[model samples]
Every structure is written in C-alpha cells, then in structure tokens.
Target chain A: MQNHKTLWQIFAAPILIGVLSSIGLIAALVGDGWWDGISWLTLALPVLLYFFFVLRRRRVNS
Target chain B: MLLLCITGLPLIFHHEIDDLLHAEVKPAEVAPGTPMADLDKLLANAMAKSPGQVPHFLIWDRDDPNAMFVSVGPTITANPVNNRLVRMDAHTGDYLDSPDVTGRFTYIMLKLHTDMFAGLPGKLFLGLMGILFCVAIISGIVVYAPSMRKLDFGSYRSHRPRIVRWLDVHNLAGILLVMWTVVVGFTGVINTWADLVLKMWQFGQLAEMTAQYKDREVPTKLTSLNSAVEVAAHAVPGMTPSFVAFPGTIFTSKSHYAVFLRGETPVTSRLLKPALIDAETGKLTDSRDMPWYVSTLFISQPLHFGDYGGMPLKILWAILDVLTIIVLGTGVYLWLRRRKTGVSTVRAIAQTSAVEAPLASS
Candidate 1:
C-alpha cells in the first residue's frame, strides 16, 4: 500500500517549525519567566515534530 | 563546509561541555547575601599573577559573582587578540590553577568551525562558503518546487530505490530547514565580519563618542572602579554593567571610563550600552544605546550561538545541524547518483512517449 500523507501532514513540519521558531523568538524578546517557558517550548517544538517522522516509519514497518 | 558546521555542534553546548571538564572551577556557589568581593582586591590579585602588565579591562560576570576575568596586554592600544586573559577568584581573590577551557576540545572545535586556524583569511573564506551555502539553499528550494508540486511535501517513498528514498527525504528536510538554514546562514556570515563591523564602529561611533575628549591628556589619577560602575548603572536605572573599560583601553575614551551596562532580561542582555564616565571624577560623561551595526552584531550572536535560549535550544540546533549535514551529503549523493542513472525516470518516459505517439499517429 502506498503512503499518502494529508495536506496537514505534508505541511506540518515547515508550519510548526517556522511558527514555533517565530514564537520562541518573540518570547525571548518578551523577557523571562512565563516568556522563557514559552520560548523553551516553542524552540524545542521542531525537534519534537521530528519524532513524528520516526514514529510514522515505525508504524509502517510494524 | 559540512565538516565545519558539523564541528560546531559541540560548540553550541560549549558551556556545558566546558563545565563538565572543569567542574572545580565552576565558581563556587556562595551563600545568598554574602558580601560581594572587592574589585580592587581582585585586580591586585590578578596583577600579581602577571606582573609588569597593565590590565585592559576588569570584568565581573553579571550572572556569576564567584570569579572575575581580567584581560591584560602590553599596552592599552593593542588589539584584543594579543591580550592574555586571567581568571581570578572574585570572593577570596585566589588564583585557581585550573585546566583552561580555552585549551579544551570545544575551543579546538570553535577554531575549526570559525577559521581553521588560518585567522582572517580563513574567516573570510568561510564567509564566502556561507554565501555559497545561502545560494545552495535558494537553488535547492527552486529545484524542489516542480517535484514537490506533484508530490505532497515530505512524501518519502521507502519501497523505491535507496537513492530515490534519500532524494525524497532530502527535499523534505531541505524544505523544513529552509527558514532556519537561511537565518543561521545570514547571521553566521554577518558574525564572521564582526571584526570589520567593530573596526567601523571604532572609526565612526567611538570617534563620535570620544570626539570632545580628543587631544585631551589621558587621565592620570583614576577614581574608584566600583564607583564608575555604580554611576553607569545609575545612568541606566535597573540595569547592571557587563564590563568596565579603563580609560586607556581601546573601548574607552582617552579621559573617560567606558562602563557598558546590559539589561537583565534575555532581549536586552544581548545589547550592551556603554556609559562613558569621567576617569577622575566617576561622573557620567555620555550614555547612549549602541549604534545599529554593533547592535546587529550583538543580536546575531544569540542566533548564531544558539546559547541565548537554554540547553533545550542547543539540542534543537544540534539536531537541525545533523539534518543539514545529511541534506548536504544527500544532495551530493543525488548529483553523483545521476551520473550512472542517466536521464531522470520521468524525463526518460516522456521522451519514449513522444516517439511512441508519433508512430501511432502515422
């Protein structure tokens, strides 16, 4: 069976990475505490999204 | 170029790597409200370490109070690279004979990443490589558009040949990394030209800052180092100084001390605003935000280093850096893979169909 990704799945990586990086950037400029927490989450997001690529392959293999 | 950026991965977490190696010199944590160490004593202690040298700057870490970094050189006008740095115990004024972090592997990686030990020419060559990298990124995007228009973004086909699978993943990763790669690339290139920007700042902004004091006799009797810092801090309320440049240092005016203050917050901390103060009087002489070029250089620092955010951001940068290496490697692989494969599968079929259609019509 062929793997056909939805538009959301296709666009997910760039959108999440770009938007979160922007958010992280904004949060950094907004100062610390809550802003720092937001910055950390947003900046760490693309790395987390990467795991989706891994899990999808694993599911297909199993 | 791939190797250079790959080497920079460890450099992204240099503080952590350095801390792991030199745990003892991590600046002993002191009890809260502990009387801060005296700057003058620290200076005397530091000078004793290297006699016959006049210190260029007295630096106290805004975040850590346990140690001081005192830079000294042959003369005040010497280039900063010629200066020797001595770290002193801020509390007890004790000199720690420790493994220098600058001599460690991370530093080597930094040298490899920045200049390959070739100095300015090497840096400029790397800057050229960075521009090429930007060009590659732009071309890669344009090249991927037609293929990606038909296939959904990130459509990696595993059942296909190995090269094809790699090709698909390469495009996916390349597209994902476009923004990040471009931003980092531009910032990295800008960072390489830092020396030039600083020299320009000295030629223009610093000249303007010290214009009135030009041709004036160098101040002989200096006031309290602590007092100059206080005056600078007072000039910009609620902000602490990052470093103090003594009267003769390149950063300071001839007759005034340059007390550079920084905001405690993440954003403002990257920007260092210098408050010029009278060397003999400890009075604020001039205070202004850094010029745009210098500020751009400072802001590019966090984007290039990825240290501004935290450990998590560094990890993210490392991951992306790895992916970028793969993208670069696969790009070469695909170009090579085409050598044996001849024309692309789509183009081959199109050519065959063109001939077949003519025969059928005849």
Candidate 2:
C-alpha cells in the first residue's frame, strides 16, 4: 500500500471534488432562484480545484 | 462509444447555443389577442404570396407582441425537409419576409444530425447509427461491470499505469452517466425518426379517439384560424400556445386546427398543449393530455438536452459532456495500446478475455 499522504494525494482530492460538484449541481437544480448564479460557480469550481490539486500533488510527490 | 460521445455532446448544448444565437433573430410583429379568424385571414394572405404551397403550421410568438411565423409546403405532401417558411405581421397577416432557408446553417446541421442529409438514406443511416450507438453503450456497460465489481463506486486506482488510470476514470464516468446517457440516446433515436414514431403512436391510440370523428360530417367551410385558437385557449386556460397546425395539414383532419399548448409547470413543459378544433365550426372538438409517445417526446427534449435548470444546468451538462469525450478518447487509446501490444482489436470480449484472462483477472 502507498503512504497515507500519497493515498490522499491520489484519492481524497478527486472524491472531495466530485462530492462538492454533485452538491452544487443538486442545489442548482432544487435551490431557490436567488442562488442561481452560484450554481454556475458550483459546476465550474470542481474542475478548477481538481486541476489545482493534481498539479500541487505532483510537485509535492516529486 | 465514439458515436455517443460525439452526438451526445452537441445535443447537450444545443439549447445553450440556440438561445445565445437566437437573440439576433428578429421576430415579426403580431397583434395581441388577435381573433382566430383574423389570424387565419392573415395566414391566407401570407400563403397567397407563396402561391404554390399550402400552409402547414402557424406559430405565434407568446413573448413578442407582434410576431408570427408560418411554415408552408406543396399541397398533398408531408415531408419536413421540403417545407418553406413565411414570416408575416401577426396583426395584419401581411407577408413581411421569406428568407430563402433552403441551405442555411441551422437547417443544414439539423438535416445532417437527424438524417445525415441523405433524405431517406440519411434518415436510415442515422437510425442505424443510433442503433449502433445504443449497442456501444450496452457493450460499454458490460465491460464496466467486471472492473467496477472489484473497486468501490467512484474509486480510482492511480497507482496503475497511465492507461489504467485513465481507464478507471473512463469507467467511473461511463457507469455514473449510464442512466442519463441511455435516456438521452433512446429519446434521440425516437426523435430522429419522429415522423414514423408519431404515426405509429397515433395509429395505435389515436385510432380509437379519432374513430368517431372519421365518419362525422367533414365540413367544407372551415372555421377561421382565429376562432379555433380562441376555442383552444378557452379549453385550456392559462396554458401558453406553442404552435398551431392549420387545417389541411397532417396534424389534423382536413377540417380542424390542432393548437399545441404548453403548461407553465416543469411536468407540463413535456406534456404539451393539445386542442383539436373543428375544421368548419372553429370550436373545440377535443382537448386532452398528449398520448404516451407524444408526451415521451415532449419530456425527453429537456431531459436529453439538459436544458431544465437554465444556465447553470447547461454549464454542468457541457462539463459532463466534455468528460464523456475524454472517457471516449481514453477508451480508444486503451484499444490502440492493446493493438500495439499485439492483441487483435477485432476479437470478441470473450476471446480477448480468454487470451488476456491472466492479465485482466489479476
């Protein structure tokens, strides 16, 4: 098995990102009209965060 | 997989792009609450200019104060590809403009996407493509089950090689999106062959509803379009009119106006406005919810296109669609890599598994 940090590096980030995005998506679907703008951010935020997490993890692992 | 990825991506965003681009589309002026008779007169005047063709459908803009569009075609025919468009002043029914839409981008893309632009051949090819796409999706799911069986849902084994890493991502996306993708794909298949589908549905359920009317006195003096629209509106109060098919069209008997209304609710958005007016009396002859297949068509549109929740929903659809593209690309990559490794790509899963059983089972 890999080190705990490596495991976190490999899994936690993506899982967290997916869960966060899913929440935002469901909220956008069922949320009040006032929260509409935040919905787009919710969809886009995960993709951006995932990229950052991957790049930062790569640097640290090296 | 390739077909679904390509076709599904555009479908997912069709609403977004159409809305963004349609802002430039200038709507013709229409008089509010114009009587159905006057609207019919206006349509007649508009059709008089287009001489050789008979009117098919009349669309009034619910939002635009003075805008109406009419589609006309050669008499005694019902092919979607061969129709002509005429825009007129809704209040006066005077022909304002008739853009030569024979080879426009929108029409071209629609034709290509729906039927491959080969007419019957194109439609048949697209039908085949839809079938193949469905098969690919099923096969993809079959392939996913074994791999996903070992790993937890959404799990990604990143310690594997690049190909395996990508493969896990592909599997996860595919399995998660399977239900949505299948819904969209099946509906897309139904839509691509809508003319046939509608006919089949109509013949099945509508045959009973229309059986009595078939023998009734068919009136030569048709009720004006204006009255018919009014009668339909009266039947379904608060429903917004989507479009109205004039008499002598496929949507209705030679003596009726079929006004398709839309409900304001999310559920109603897919159910559609259904009011059939007598051809001669311009009065409501029948009003009811759409038949099952028609309702299926109605609801499938927003679900397939992912246009339900507005801009945010569209953005989410686009991202998911892009991810799907990546998954498709990775699948192709894995196949190519296996080929490079001297495995024949044509082998059935069973045969391939037999050979690579030792490798894959591990």
DockQ of each model vs. true complex? 0.31, 0.14
Cα deviation in Å at residue B200, candidate 2? 2.4
Docking class of 1: acceptable
Candidate 1, B22-130: lDDT as tens digits:
6655555677766656677777777788877877887775545677788887777787675777777777766653245457898889888888888889888898999
TM-score of chain B of each: 0.89, 0.77
TM-score against truth, every candidate: 0.87, 0.73
True contacts kept of each: 0.31, 0.10
**Stretches of candidate 2 above 4 Å error?**
A2-62, B1-25, B28-38, B61-66, B89-96, B119-162, B215-220, B342-362
lDDT of 2 at B76: 37
- Report each candidate's C-alpha RMSD, comma-separated, in the order given: 4.7, 6.7
lDDT of 1 at A8: 59
Local distance difference test scores for all models: 0.75, 0.64
